[model samples]
Structures are given as C-alpha cells and as structure tokens.
Target chain A: MRTEDFLRDITAIRGLSGDEGPVADFVADAFRPYCDEVWVDQMHNVIARKKGGGPKVMFAAHLDEIGLMVVNIEEDGSLRLGQVGGVDPRILPGQRVWVYGKDRLLGIIGAKAPHLLSAEERSKNYQREDLYVDLGLPPQRVREQVQIGDQVQLEHRYTALQNGRVAVKTSDDRACVAMMFEALKQLQNLRHEADLYFVATAQEEVGTRGAITSAFALDPDFAVALDVCHADTPGAPAWRTHKLDSLVASMGPFIHPVLRGKLVEVAKEQNISLQTAVVPRSTFTDADGIGEARAGVPTVLLELPLKNMHTTVETLDSKNLREGGRLLAQFAVAVNEGWEDELWT
Target chain B: MLRDTLQTLLGAYGPTGQEHLVADKVRELLSGHVDSMRTDALGNLIVEKFGAEENAKTIMISAHMDHIGLVVTDIEKEGFLRVHAVGGISPRLVAARKVVFADGTPGIVALEPNTKGKKEPEMSDLFVDIGADSREEAEKLVSIGDVAVYAPDFTALGRHKVASPAMDNRCACALLVELLMYAEGQKNTIVGVFSTQEEVGLRGARVAAYAVEPDIGLALDVTAWGDTPQTKLPAVKLGAGPAVKIMDRSMIASPYVRDKLFEAAQAAGVAVQREVLAFGGTDGGAIQLSRGGVPTGTLSIPCRYVHSANEVIDLRDMEGALKVLLQFIELA
Candidate 1:
C-alpha cells in the first residue's frame, strides 16, 4: 500500500500521548501483514517482530499527535482549552477542531470580530487563553454531553500540495511511522537476515517515555530512530532547517557514529539522497533513549524533512518519506554480525 | 453527606506540606469503613477498601487534601507582612481577601496602590495585615514559613451550588470517603489516597504511586469552569455533572481507564462531561507515569474560581461523581 494511504488512515484518528490505544492497534494491524508476530504493550507500544539469525534490529517512530485539551466550559456552551503537546496557540483562532467529547463533534475556534476589539486588542495576537471552542450546541445539552478535559483534536485536513507534498495532522512522527510501514513493505522481499522489530512507539511527544520503555523491552542489537525534521519554512531560522528533497541522518553524541556511517553508506549504495543534521546534544527523538538501553545499542537517527512542525497543516514531501523507507530497509540488511564489533573500531 | 464531609475537610487547616491535620480528619471519617489505612512518608493518607473477588485489580483513587495558601516570607516593621504564594495564588485575585492561619489568627490580604492606572500587580505588590502594631507583635501570632489560607466561609449559593476555599479537592475527598462507605462487595480493591501537597506539585501522589504500584489509577479533583461570565472554553458547567478528564498539563488519561469511566457513568445512570484541562494537574498525572506505568484517568468535580476564596461547586456534580465512582470500583 502507498504511504499516503496509511497517512490518510492514521491522521484522522485522535490518539494523544498516554492515550494511543486505537493508533497502536492500527499500527499493529498495519505491521501484521508484513511481519511474523505482533503485539501491543499496555503502554500502547506496537511491536512487530520478524525472527532471523542475524543481528536484532529495531526501527521506531512515535504514533502520538499534538492537540488542545478542554480546560473549562462556558455557560453559553463554549469550551476553554489548553495545549496537549506543543500546540501553537497562534494557529488556533478560526481553526476547526474535533471535540472528542460524548461524540467526535465538529467544533470551530472563533476569532472575536474586529468590530468588537479595541485598538489595543487589535494590535496584539490572541493568546491561547483567548481562544475557546464553539461546538454550536445548546448550553444545557452541552452540559449533558461534553466534559472538561476532553481532547480537542486538530481537524484532519489532508492537502496534497504541488510537487509530491502532503499536509496532514500528526504527520510529524506518524509520517515516520508510515515510513516504517514503507520499509516493512519493501523488506517483505529484499531481506538478508536481521531479526527486525518495527515499533510505533507511544508518548514520544511526552518526553520520549515510550521509547525508553520499549527499547528496554526489545533490547535490540541495533536501533534506527526515525522522525520528522524541520524543513525550511517561512521565517524559520535557516541554521535549524533542512530541505524537503532528501532524508536526514543525524550525527551527534546521542547517535552511534559507525552506525550512522553505515546508514549513509547504504543510502549512497541505494542511490537515495541523504542529508546530515549535526545535533550537538540530544537529538530530541528516540535516538537519545534507544542508544542508552541495556549497555547501549548502536543507534541511527533518520529524519524526513517536513514543514510546519506543530501546526495543523504539518507538510511533508512524499519522495523524502519513501526514500527514508528504502534507506532504513537497506540499513537493516547491511547490519551484519560484525556490525556490533565495528562500533568501537 | 458529601456536602457535610466536604465542609468538614474544608474547615481543616492543611497547607501544601502540612496535610496531617486533614489526614487526621479523614482518618476519623474513614476509620471503620476501610479495611486498612496508613500515612506515607509524604504524609499521604492511603486507605484500602477490599473487594470480594480474588485476583482483582488494585485500583487507586486519589484526592489531594492540601489547599493553596500564602507562606509568610518576611514581616514589615509596621506589622504588614510580606508573603510568597504557596501554589497558584494570583495576587490580583487575593487582594482584599480574608485569610486565617492554622492557629485561628485572621488577617486581610492587601494590594499596594499602583501608581499607573490599569497596571497589573504582582505578589510583590501585595501584603498581609493581621491587626498588629509591630513586627514583633505580628511574629507572636504568625512566624516565617507559616501558611495562611482563605478563611473558611462556606455558603450555599442559590440551591445546588456552594462556595468556599479548598473545594478544589475537598469535594473529591468527600466523594472518595462516601464511595468507601457506600461500596460493598466490589470486584476490585479500591485504595483511596488522600494525597498531600498536590497544590505545590503531585508530591504526595508520586511517592504513594511508587508504594502502591496499582494496576489502575484515578484522580478525583475539581476542574475549572467556563460557564461563569467571560471565562470561555472548557465547556464544563458547575451544576451539570462530574467530568471525565481526557488530558491535562500533567497527564493524558489512559484510554482503557478513561473509557471505563465513561462506561461507569453509563452504568450508574449518571451524567459526566469529558474534560480537557490546560492548566494545573491532579495526582493521576503522577500515578499514570509511575514505575512501568499505570492505566489512569481523572474524575473531576466541576469547580469555579479554584485556588481563590469563595471557590464554587455544585452538589449535583459531586453526587454524579460519587455515583460514577461507586460503579467504577466494581467494574475496574
């Protein structure tokens, strides 16, 4: 199946951190057709395994999404909200949201009319607190149904932009999860011998908690942490952003150098355009956590360049996401028995 | 009974780190109802109500006992006292508010005059006056590190709603205490933790979760309301019913546990709202991420003006939450 197909299916779901059950199930089902065994942990980490005599390898990307949470309810039936993850309040006003209350109700975040605002209020942007959701329900019915603390999801609007680009909610890490699916689809035929475990980790948005636990549970000989990187966006600093045409293999203290070198070599061998991201400290992905699991696992961090990092329209280049799959699949095949000993050398 | 229990707990003098007095009151109420009870290192009152079935899940329900207060930082020579907020006390809200120390010493919080009109004031712009002549006289009744909370002023608002300080959690405490007293032959072991220092942080619940390592966790607390005037969003109303927390700053409610709460509401034939709080946290946050992890959700009593004097809640919501908890313990 196409990566966009998986993205289409996954983006519409509302699975925030610590509440990724359905997303985990979807991932497990997605991997079931491509692997030998699959199971979801209590923490909702979907682990799909393929046994082999070669080195044990793990590929992971978080499956959770960022959204706003209901903080209060207005008597007139409006809903107050807070950020679930790094939800940009600047992008909130006039945006449509899915209120996951008694029902997955359609809600709109309204901006106060310019006529209603004073000159002082007009000069400033609305803070997150200034925004409230209007579910368009009666006040009494709203009280009967909606609860405080229900998640307000970013409405899933998949826009296929020019030049093989797709914008979808949760494309940040879920795009990488789809990339893992792409790798799995390719690995069905082009396998060497690595015992592969593809994990769609939970709660990565909440400080990489799932990666820490899942890595400890899987204990792979080699791990490849795949996630999205900031593609060049308007007003974003050039130093921190990458292009959308290629996949990025990050090199830093957290990433294993030899393993990264091996990934770069595989990308070169596979003729996939690969870029390098120099993260001086924490990669801020599963790479930091998986690298230190049980006397250290040789780990590599792969990045798919995406635009609009935390906004509803998280854009990504389909070509780069597909290239990431090929690179990861080739890396799994390239990780032979001597790969572990070569880390020190 | 929930109202009376809440009123009693609200009357107890317990600040963030000083919840032993509240715990004492809780013990007195629950002494005979629970199977076992103990105080943890953090002064959390942990009590268990056993189930009839064997191999049942260890479900922990937590309601914090501590209230937000002002700690005496320094005393002025003229007897006005300098203070720092212990929790989420807004200087603007506390100005001209009445407070009382644990020893029944009453005082009034006063805000310094702002030279610029329409300028926002801060804690530094505020002070406490205890009708004292000098620093020594003020020190005789109050000391440094002594906490002063909103003096108890419980008033019934209209019919269903009631107003007071510390109703943020005392309402939940009442819900838990009543659940323990009401539930019989439940299928799961219910451990009620009257946790300490939650207003400061989830300090008491953190250690309590480590000790209990429960199979599931639930936090009972008050959530903010948007029904009153300009406070838009959060969609929760006081008189409607209790709320089921979806996510908060401290945690994303575990789906299995949160969904079961919904089912429990259905089973109990009670009303419940889905909650998504942006600010503050409950003990469930600590319990959800404890050790490996525990499936956890929060049941919130819809409260207004939380952390301020005259915090308001509806008894109907408390009743709905108690009904849900009674059904929840049996199902979970």
Candidate 2:
C-alpha cells in the first residue's frame, strides 16, 4: 500500500502515551527508507533526520493513542479501568477490547443489565466507575495473566465509509503520523536547503513530553507540528470546528504567526485547501512545546481536521491527508536559511 | 560586599530578551579576574576561569541575568500602553507598580476597573501609564515590543537581608560574580555563564550547555521560601544558607551532583537547606538535559516572594553559598 494509505495499519498497532515501543518500531521502519538516519529516543520519539547545511526544520506528529489501563482486578476476573489519556466512558458499553496482559487476551466491557437497574440509576448516564471488563477466565487465571497496569485498548473496527472517508481508532494522531510519512516521500523529489527532521513524537496526550525533549535535543531553528483538529460534526459548536476536507493552520501566542502565514502561503500556492484556526492562547498541541524549546523556535501547528475526535471512531477524508503532506513538503522547500530573517519581518 | 555587587547589577536595565546590559555589567566586574569572556548568539556571557590542575574537567556554572518584565503589545488610542508579561509576571503583582523601560523611561502600571465584581483582571485589562497625554507622546517614549521591568529599588530589611525587584536572579548573578572573582586554583575549568532568557524558559542555558558541553553543570538561582506562614510545602527557610535542589518542574538534580553539594557544604562548614520546589525551574534543568545529559544540580538562594517587586534574600545565604561553591568546584 501507499504510505499515505497505511493510516489504518498504523492506527491498528497499539501505542498508548508513554508505552510506544511497538509504534516506534513500525514508524522507524517506515521512516528508515526515506531519510538519512532514523533513531528512537528513550522516550520512544521516532526521529528521522535528513541532513543539510542550512537551518534545521523539525516536523512533529504524535504517535500515542488514547486508551484505558487495568486499575484493579476483582475476584470474579473483572478489571477496573482508568484513563490513559481522554477516554470518553460514553462509548464503553459492551465493546470488545484488547487486553495487553501477560498474554494478549480479548475481553468485553460489562455493565449492569438495563432490566435490573433502579430508576434513579437508569435516569442518569453510566459512570466509568459503574463499568468493568470481564475476561472469560477463572479468577486464578486472570491473576496469573493480567496485572493492574497492563494497557487496554478500546475496540476498533476500521471502516471505509462513502465518499472516501475512513473511520479508525487513534486517527486523532496516527493519521497525522502517516501524513508526515507522506511528506517525507514527497520531499525526495523536492529541493530544500533546510535540514529536515521528521519526528513521530510520543506522550503528547499526557503533556507534550516527547516534543519537549526532542525539540530541545534537535534544537531546530523552526518547526511544524501536525495533529488532528476537531472537524465539523453535527450538534458540535460550529465556531469550534472546521470542515472535514480542509487542513488547518493555527495562530496564537505559542504558535509563530509568521510561520503559520507561511503555511497558508504554501497551501495557496499549491492549490491546497487550508483553513485558519485563531487559537487565542495555547494551541495545546506539540507546537506549544516545540516553540518554547531553547531560545524559542519559530514553530507553527498544521492540523488535519477529523470528526469524532478522541473517540474510537475518528473519521477523516483520506484525500486531505495526502493534500496536507503535499502542502508540508512544499513548505519544507519554501523554508530557506533566510526564512528566520523573514519571521521577524 | 556581595550585596554591593547585587546593588550594582540591579542598576542595569535588563529583561528576558534584553539582557545585554546585565551581561555588560557582569563582564566589567569579571574582566581581569577570568581567563576569557565571550557572548553567545542569545547574548549569554560565558566567562572561563581556567583551573590550575592537570586534566581538569569543565564545570559550567550558570546564573541567569534576565528578570521578569512586561512588553508593549499595543498602544491604546488614549495613550495607555497595553502590555503582556515577557516572563511570569502576574497582573495582580504588577498593578499600580512603577515600571522602567530599557532606556530609563519610567511608567506606572494600572488595571482597568470593571463592574465584573471581585474577579481578578487579566493582563489585557492592565495598561502602563507613562504620563503621556497622547498616543504620539507615548510613541516617543516607548515603541511596540519594547520591554519594561519593575523599577529597581533596593531596600535593606533589618540586617543580613535585602529586598529588591530583580533580586530573584540579580542576587544569584552577584553570587556567581563573587565565585568567579574568588574561586582560585580550582581543579575544574570554571565556565561561568551569566545566561539570558532563563525567565522565559531556560533558553540561553539550553543552547549554552550544548555549546559549552561541560562534564558537570550547576545553576545558581533563587528558590521560593516556605518559612512564611501558609507556605509550608517546600520546607525551606530564609537565612538558612543556600538550598541544594532535589527537583522542580524542569529537571531533577543528578543524585551524584546533589550529594556532592551536601559534601561541599559540609567541607565549607556552612548550613544548607534541601529545596523541593513544587513549581518553577532554573537553567540547571536545561544544562542537565543537554547533549547526552551532563550531570547537573542547582544551588538556590532561598528567597521569599519570588518573581515579585519585593523579592527578599538574606546576605548570609549568599556568603554561605559562595563558600560552598568554592568547595564544589574541587570536589564535584
């Protein structure tokens, strides 16, 4: 499959926020063929560097996904869950989950039957504390196979929807990761003077930790952070969402206004659809961390708009992913040694 | 004697991005005492005092020269200068306080009164009144992006204590200057970096450490005091000597370097506090994480009301810290 089309495969692999070894290995392999060098940091940040003699430009996209962890195991072989990132408990009823225990096991999220619930309890929404994961095994077997801290991924069923839209788990980020891979693929044919570092960062959901260290180590002169933004979904606040088809570029105090304008310029020149996100404060993305790295890097956040963000079914229009890659690749070409001087002007 | 040096440094007008004045002051003090001195791209003044021993390792000692300030974001039509914090300065702390621009032009910070009862005003609601009657007159005094810090006013608090606006870091800069002047026949190549933009995010030290690439690093800064009532968690006190940091939000102290600080304190016969700051960080956090990670620690002068107009520190703590740093260069 084309690298841009591999978002489903990338999202299928489990890589929770601080435990991204599996995701790192796959991302490193994908990046190995396209860049000068690829290496994984202690934080599992996959950094693929393309050496040049000009200013360094870092392109970052997080690889970690939202999930739950086994917080407790009852005597009846049921597991209690705590969120690893922002797992909405609203979608957890009777869903199949992948329990990454001593052995890979399948389990079902169980709740009280509606027929047996009291009216007071039934009137209210199901709280996460009211749910448990039932593994089909004896309590002793559960004790042997599972531990309290083992990662549990919510059920994911990748679906190809009508009009080239696709739904999959963890696409809030992995789609952007795949989009970076596509950018790397495109940069092969482009001419650029800047040293480019394509990084699949880890632990962004927790607090942009990977970007913090990676940006510090690389000390890039400029950076662009790619992540998914909430696309237009029905019943969602219209002012807060973007079209599912257009790529997003955010401007705020943390984001370099000039660098963001440069992305828009590139998008316009390349005939790619781009939208502006006027974030007043923190972008709450990797850009927030990368821009503050060292004496401060001129960093901008470019986003792919997806529907149903932070859910198991993050839906995206596949063409925009490829469009975002092309735009970023062209942006890499647009950045020269003089771009730093342009930022202040 | 160190209080005199701090008084001299506080005279210089320097904010986060504008630290050259402080660097110039530091260079003037340490000119003939050090082997070499230079400034980096970000205006960090790195001074070297060569060791008199064979095969000595390089130990980078950094004290940030930058202090908190507010920058002009826009000028309102009514001649008021709209501002935002360049560092971590709060609107509540700066309200109705006198501020000085880099060029010695002074202004007063004022908050707009709103009918929104009892709610704290934001930086947007705050403006600087430079006594300018018109926008044209305000433009003549300060331009957009020009920064202004709290007007410097050194106050002696009782004895062995002094309170000042930029004392959070100018005191540490004074201490480092004292170390460079007095640290003689040391076993390590002492690279004293009067770093810049530390209040912004340890930016100067991050790149400075990468360029210096020292075997060991230490940040001289001030830590918050818990001796004041209702401030109980940090467990540090004023006049209790300099604190050896355990950890802060930025980087955890390397255990080897942290323990060596205690040993140096013991050797110097100076009392020291153990600082565990729940918030705030220093340049040591950047130096420790630089290029394969050099072992680093911080020596903090315990100060009350840090990042305020009246940051207070004890002179005895500076004297004690100077003694310990002289021992640390050889032992660490």
Candidate 3:
C-alpha cells in the first residue's frame, strides 16, 4: 500500500472508545485484500486472520483515537465539549476542528481578545470550561445542523515535513494500526507457519478497555501491543521523553521476561537500532491486563516515538513507525518459524 | 469492643522496621485461636487456620501496623534533634506536638519562632526538643537512629465516636484480630496477616502476598469520610457504617467480589455504604496482582482526619465491618 494512502484512509474514520464501528469497517475493508479472512468481534475489534498450518501468531494494534465528545451546545452557537480520552488543554484554544455532525461542520475554538481580559483571568491557565467553539453559524442554525453528543476531531491537515515526519491528529495509535496494514500488504504471498490473528482493537485511548476485552477473548499464549511513546522536544521533561530518532525498548513489570528476551534476540539478528525505557512497574498499558489474564499470558509493548502527544499536532517521524513495523514483522516471523519447535520446547 | 486492645497496641512505639512490640502483643492475644503463627522477614504476623474442605482455597487478610512517625537524623548542639518523616505526613500537624521515642524518652516537636506566618514547617525546619541543654545529654536517653511518633491520648468524644493516635490503621489491626477470634470455630482456612511498612510503599504486603497466594484476599484499612467541614461535600458521611469499596485510585475491586459482599450484607441485614474513593491506595493493590491475580476486595472502617495524630472513628462503623466480614467469610 502507498504510505500516503494508508495514512489518509486510517485517519479518515472517526472512532473514539465505544464508537469504533466505522473504524472497524474501514480496517476490515483495507485488510481483506491481503488476508484470507477478515472479521470483526462483538466489541467492534477488527481481526484479519491469515491462514497458516503452524502455531498461532497475532499482530495487534488499536484503531481508536483521542477526540472530543460534544456534551452541550449553547444558544449563541458555542459548544461545551468533554474529552473522550486524554486531551492536552494547553493546545486547545484557538484551534480549528471538524465537528462530526450529520454533515461535517468546520469550527474553531473561540478565544477572547486579550485586550478585553482582566489581569486575574489572564494570569491563570486556560481551562476547557472557559472555552467554546465558533461554528460561524446562527444560533438556531447550529442547533438544527449539529446535535449534542457529536464527536469532533482536530482539522489539522497532514504535513509531510522535509525531515520525514507526519504531523496530524491521532497519530498516537492510529499510525501504529496503519503500519500493520502496510506489513500485511508486504507479506501477502509469503508461506507462514503460525496462524496470524491481526486485531485492530478499539477504545484503547480510554483505559485500554478494548485490548483488555480482546486479550481475554483471544487468550493467546503471547501478545504484543503497539502504542505511541513520548518523544523528546524543547520544553519536554528530559527524563520522561526520549529522542524521536532513537527506537526505545521498554523494560518493566508490564513486559514479560521471555517476550522481552525474544524481542532482544530478534533485534540482534535483524541488526536494528534500539534504546530502552525502564519502568518500575505496570506501564499503565494493555500489557497490565494481558499479563494476568486467564492464569497468565506473557505480553510485550513496542512503542513508536511520538512528540507532543495528546494534542492537536501530535507529531511523529513516519520512518520510526515504519521501522517499528519492520521490527514487529520480524518478531512475528521468528515466532511463527519456531513456535511449536523452539518456543514451547 | 476491640478499642482497648487497639489502644494498647497503638500506644506501643513500633516504627516500620521495629514492629516486634506490636507483633508480640498480637501473638499473645491470638495464640490460642490460630492453628499456627509465624513472622515473615518484614515482621508481618501471619496466622493460619485449617478449613473443613480438602484443598480449600487460602484466604489472606492484611492490616499494616506501622504509623506515621519521625526518625531522628541529627542531634544539634542545642539539643534539638533534626528528624525526617518516617511516612507521608503534613508538617502542619507536627508543631508543638508531643512525641515519645522508642525507649520512652519524651520530646516536643518545635519549629523556629522566626517563621511565624508559616502555615506548615517543612521537615527540614522542624526539630524535636527533648529538654536537654547539650547534644551529649540528649544522646544519653535517645540515639540518633531512634524513631518517635506523636503521642495522643485516646478519648471517647460521644456515644459512638472515639479519637486517638494511630487510629488510621490500629482499627484495621484490631479488626483482623477480632475476625481471627470470631472465626476460631469456623471450618475454612484463614490467614490473618498484620503487615508492617505499609506506609513505606506497601513493601510488607507484597512479600506476604507472594507467600499466601490466596484465591481470595481482603485488605482492611481506614477510609476518609465527609464528617468534617473540609471533606468534599456529597462525600461518604461518617456514622453511616463500614464502607464496601467498589473502586479506589489504586485497585478496582472485581465486580464479582463486590457483588458477593453486597449480597452477604443484604442477607445479614447490616448497614453498608458503597465507596468510590477518588484518591489514596491500599494494600489491595499488591494483593490483587499477586500470583497471576486474585479476586480481592476491601472492607474499610470510615475515619475522619486520617494520617494525623488525632484520627477519629465511630465504633458503630467497626461493628458494621465485623458483621459484614463474618458474613462474607461464611459465604465466600
């Protein structure tokens, strides 16, 4: 698949937590061309199964994105919004977004003119309750056009910079999902030993409920979850975020020792560049639940470097996501080739 | 009912690593009822009881015996002892308070008189004065490594309310002992573990959990309530009853375990409150994730002014907890 086409198609669907039906349908459509069978689960997770006569291997990523839920719309065409997942309030003011109404409506967050503001209010941090959206519509017209509880996403147009980075909304896990599709396209005609269950999970942004339920249902012997990692930038805490150019290998209570060892072996064999993020316990990811599900299931987390996450312009080097996909595909191949013979043995 | 024993235990000076005094007191009281008793590496008291069925699932109950105290770091020339907080504590509660060292040496915590407008003195600015003129004189009675806690006399405020020091968790330890005593005739295997160093990151419970590996685990502790003015309005009120926690910041209790507790409370006709604490954690965090996970729940005794020298609780809440817990053990 063309990288540009993959990015556009994956970012087009609106899926936030419980409302992942459209995103699942889009993923199933995109994955059917490369897999034997593609289906969705009761929880709206899209699973594209590649037929194989060997051990089962699952490549999983989340399809949901962090967006806003329109709670109430005021009489003067202003809307009060609540974040569906974690939304950084610092970047929300004066930002343009698309309100997912019956017909898409363009809106911009209305900020008061600084000249009119008093000294006390200006000294404080900006709050979501103090902000509203300007849809450029009359009071009655807006109520007639956009109802309450509609979802809204940032309308920042994708920017492919000279440095090979893609600036867009929902690059967090959506980009991870796109990489899986690209890998499937590349491995279409390959004869594999392990049965591949590629799951595009939903609602991972809101406390990893999608991954938790999916892991419980599948009950795989081993699992890997792909999510975005914080990238180093100006004003970022040096200790928390890593450099975008470096591929961080996470080690912690969330990562199983066997899975971590296997990842290290595969990276060594493939000669890939990798760094490490050592967490004391439970990285607050789907791996927490997957590690303890049904007696236990060993899990690993492979993070794609991202900068300014949970904001309108959450940026990522597209090449980093591509490399992450290569690493994951390599690990899948390694597991598939030696599953019953070496992994269990 | 258990207040006498809890006050006696709380009055004893037992810091994180020096919990032997309180553990020995519990050992003496509960020796006859338990089938066997042993102390773990962290000084956690583990008591066992045999069950009726063969290969019955082991159940573990935990309560930390450590209270927030001050650890001596330096003895200044003027006999003022520089101290560090043994656990998480606010400096506002330390000034002009009475503290007793491990060897019964008395002291008064004081802040510099120059900082008058200070709402609270940082641990660096606070010192304990044991009324000695020189460092040598102070060292005669107290060592540089001695630990001390604020001493508050227990008093009955009203018909059901009682105020005392270390009530934040002495109530929990007392309840565990009472449950062990009440379950002497029962058939199920019970492990009552009085943990240490819970305030220092739940280190004791983690080790105890691995050893127990129980199918069911219950953490007994005190929870905050809206009895005082500063508590958030529309919060859990005092005098209601024991709280059955559905969710807390640290651990989300399994819905199945929550429903079972609720069902048992209904059958016994006990007054119970459903709790959803916005902050603070419990030993339930480690217990729930132990040995590939265990179904866990918390039975909390609602207390006001927790982690303070003068924490208050209602005896009716304790009675309610005992009733619901006895019923749960029978049905679990």
Candidate 4:
C-alpha cells in the first residue's frame, strides 16, 4: 500500500478505546489476508498469527482511539461529555464534533460567550460540567436523536499540506494500525523461524488493558508496540515533543529496558532516524499494562511522531507512518532470526 | 499444623518492607518440599513445582504476606508517637490496642476511646504510647521512622473459629502452604506466590499476575462474613466452607472458572456457597485484565471483623477450601 493509502485507511477506522469492536473487525479483515489466522480475544484485542518454525515474536498496535463518551443527555438537547481517555477541555470548546448518537448527530462543543463572562470568570479554568455539546436541533428532536453513552469524535477532514504532512481525527493510534497492516503485507512471503503475532489492541486509551490480557495469552519471547508519539509543533511543549526526523520510542514507566535498547539498535542498523519519548511514569499506551501481564513479558513501545494529538487536526507525515511500519517489520525479522538470547541474557 | 504455621508466621516481626523475617521462616518451611524457589524484585516469594509435561502452562496462586500497621510520622516532646495507618485501619478498633515494632518492642496505641454518646476519634487524633518520658528517650527505643503492627495474639473462638490480628489474609497464606504440602507430585505445574501489599490496592497481585500470566488465576483472600448479630443473616458466615467468588466489584468471575470451581466442590463433596460482594475489589481484577486476559476467579474464606486487629475465621472453612482447590488443580 502507498503511504497515503495506509494513512487514509487508518483515519477511516473509528474506534474510541472502550468501544473497539468495529475497528477490531476492520483490523482482522486486513490482517487475515497476510497471516495464517486472525482471532480476537475478550478485550477485543485482535491477534493475527503468521506461523514460522521457531520461537514466537508478538507485535502489538492499539486499535482504539481517544475521544468522548456521552455521559448524560441534558434536557436542553445539549450533551454532557465524559472523557474516554484524556481530553483537554481547553482544546475541546468551539471545536466541531460528530456525536455518534442514535443517529449521526452533528454538534459543536459550546463555550460560554466571552461577551457574557466577567473578567474573573474568563480567568478561571472551565470544567467539563460547565460546558456541553450543542446540536442545531430542538430539545425534543435531539432527545429522539442522541442518547446517553453515545460516542463522539472531532469531525475533521484528512488534508495533505505542502510539505507532505497529513492531518485528521484519531491519528494518535489508528495511524499505527494502518502501518502494521501495510507491514504485514510486506512480510507475507518472508521465511522466518519465530511465529509473528500482529495484534491490534483495544481499550488502550483508557488503560493498557487489552494488551495486558492479549500479551499474556500469546506469551511470546518478545513484544513490540507500535503507537503514536508527540511531534514538535508550534506552541507544543518543548520538553515533551521531539523532532519528527528521529524515530520515537517510549522510555520510562512501561518500556522494558532491554527491549527498548534492542529496538533502538534495530533502528540504528536500518539507519532509521530515532528519538526518545521520556515517559517518566507511564506512557499512556498499551505497554504499561502489557509489560506486567503474565509474570513479565519484555515490551518495547515504538511511536510515530504526530502533531496536535487528541485534536481534530492530529497531523503526521505520510512518510513517517510508513517508516514506523518498516521499523517494526525490521525489528520482527531481527527477532525471527535471534533476539531471545539477548533478551534472557 | 495450620495453627502452628500461623503462630510462626504471625509471631515473626515483619510488616511490609521489613518482611525478611517472615520470608526467611517461609523459606525454611518449604525448603525441601518445592522443586525451586526464588524471591522476585518486589520481594514476593515465588515457589515453583514443575508439571509432568514439559513447558506445561504455568498457574500462579497468590496470597499476600503483608499486614496493616502504623508508620511513625511524628514524635511529640512528651514521647507520644503520631502514626499514619499504612494499610486500612478502623480508627475505632485501634485505640488502646497493644502494638509490636519490627524490633519486637511492645507499646500501646493510646487514643481517646469512644464513650456513650461520643463519636470515635479519627487516626489523626490518636497516638502510640511507648511509656517514654521524653522524645530523646523514645528515640532510643523506637525511632520516628519506625513501623509497628497490632501485637500477635490468636484465640480460639466459638465453633472452631480462630481470631487473630493478621487472619484477614494470613488464613489464605496458610491454605496455600497446606496445598503445597498435599500437592506432592501433582500432574500440573503450580507457581505459589506469597505476594506483598495486597492490603494496599492489590499491588503485589497486580505484578505477580502479570509476570506469571496464568491461563487461570484464583486469589485466596478473606471475604466479609455477615453471620454476626449486627450483620445480615444467611450471608457469608464462618464454617460455611470456601466461598466461591461469583462476582466482586473488581471483576465478574468468568463462567468457565465458576463452573470449574463448582464442579470441584460438587465432586469433592465440600460445602460451598456463592459470593457476590457489593463493594471492595481483589487481585482478581488485576488478573482478569492481565495480557489479553485470563479466566480469573477467587476463593474467599469467610472472615468476621475484616481489616481489624482480630479477624476471625473457622478452620473447617479453610479445610473445605483446600479440598476444592486441590481437586481443581489436580485436573487443571
């Protein structure tokens, strides 16, 4: 698949963490053709196994996306949104969104008008309870249309800018799903010893939940996590974000130190540009849960640097997405040859 | 044997991080019985007995060794020790109770006792009295950084129930040890984990479950019994045998596991009852969500006065629980 085509397919998948069945189905359909078999576990984690004659190597990418769940439907037709993952309220207001109600109800995150606000009121941090999503419909119509526990995401167009950067919704991790699919297609005919488990995990945004259960079931010699990372952008926190040229790997809280080093070595051998995502505590990825699942499976988190994370305009380079995929495939092939000795030693 | 084991374990002055004494005692007891054993990074006791089949799927059975205690946060001029409860402690049950430090020094938790028509004092309003005149004298015996727990004292109660400070979970730990003794040359592999910090967010179980990644996990812990006068009748009671946890706030017991446990109970002719806890969570929640997930369940011994100094349980329930568990693992 072309890089843009892969990116497009990922952006097309609409999975919001806790509700990941649909995206898992989509991932299974694409993954089944390239592997021997595909199955999903209870956590809605999709596992596609490409069997070889040696030890197993499992690679995981979360299929879930961070968005909003409708906690309550207010009487005035406005929707109260509860964060499925972490949603900054500062960025939520005034943004256009698609509320996946009983029907496709279009809405906007409404903020109190600045004209009506006192200077002191404007200075205070706004709580999610103080705001609601406004659909341009009467209360009765909205009541018939939307319901509690509906999913919502920012409805944004996937656009390509002049410098090959693309922007869209749910790109934080759907981008990784696309990359894994393309990588599997590329590795279909390769002669390898280790059984390759390509898993698209679920509920990762809420917690590294699916990965914990899925990784334990697989019990591979090694694991590689393909997900999204923070890319340097204008007004982005300088310390947290990194340059796009470098391949970003998760650092603390989750990444197994040896596994992280091995992936870094693979990136170096392939001459792939690399960077480090210093997650001092937890990386809000599948790695945190997967690392400690079933005794202790060594895990490495590989990230595709993206800009405007959790926003409608989540942007990334099409080339970077493909690079992330290639890096994962290379890491797998390296493991297929011999990675266990190093892992154990 | 169970009572002696409990006495040895409880008598050892070990609280949370200073569990070396208890671990050493456990190692001595299980030395020749298990095939291999090792202490993990987080201070959990991992004892393993291999199955007949090579590389048979691993099963981890966890029981925590940690107990609730006090950490001295501050020491006043008059030698009163201000403490923070390390794990869950009822402020009402704490006042005037005797305590033992890790060094075996004895003291009393001196707090304002609740009187008629008076509310119980919170933990902050309480202090530990070690009978020292000055802070300088108290420092010689127990330092401000020291930790202590309610002193060990086991008493046989009505109808086979035994009450003790750490019986809330130490009963489960005893059962695991008993299972190990009876599990000689078992067909399937068993990883016995005497986990740490179960009283605090099931932290040790979380790590141990993730590491072992069993096809199935069964947490052996104590559950609340409402058999007493203050509690509702026909609820979990002492001597009701092992309570098969059907559901708890933390996890929904997988049907596969629930059936297995039921079958084991029926086949062994052991008394069994269903338990659906309204509140509180267990290591089952941690194991249920462990990699991709495992079919997780729990077997809880019914205990009265949980999270208190003197948790009470019937030894008959422990025996019944062991029978069901051994039968389950024999065919597992």
Per-model TM-score of chain B: 0.98, 0.99, 0.95, 0.94
Interface RMSD of each: 3.1, 8.7, 8.7, 8.8
Candidate 4 Cα errors over 4 Å, as ranges: A1-3, A72-77, A98-104, A135-150, A235-239, A249-271, A276-284, A293-295, A342-345, B1-79, B88-199, B203-284, B291-332
Worst 10 residues of 2 chain A by lDDT: A1-10
lDDT of 1 by residue, B1-332 (tens): 88888889889998889989999999999978989999988899999998888899999999999888899999999998999999888898899999999999999999888876757788889999999999999989999999998899999999898999888778888888999999888999999999998988798998899899899999999998978788754667888889888777787788889889999999999988877666678998888767656888999988898888988999999888888998898888
Candidate 1 ranges beyond 4 A from true positions: A2-22, A50-59, A66-169, A185-197, A203-224, A249-301, A310-313, A326-345, B76-80, B102-107, B116-118, B130-143
Candidate 2: stretches off by over 4 Å: B1-332
Query: Comparing only chain A of model 4 with the true chain A, what is the TM-score?
Result: 0.92
The best candidate by DockQ is 1
TM-scores for candidates 1 onward, in order: 0.81, 0.56, 0.67, 0.60
First chain of candidate 3, TM-score: 0.92
Span of ten consecutive residues with least summed lDDT in model 1 chain A: A143-152
Candidate 3 docking quality: incorrect, acceptable, medium or high: incorrect
Models sorted by TM-score, best on top: 1, 3, 4, 2
Candidate 3 displacement at residue A226 in angstroms = 3.2
Model 3 whole-model lDDT (C-alpha atoms) = 0.77
Model 4 Cα lDDT, one tens digit per residue, A112-142? 8888889998998777657789998999998
Model 2 clash pairs are: none
lDDT of each: 0.87, 0.88, 0.77, 0.78
Specify the highest-lDDT model's number.
2
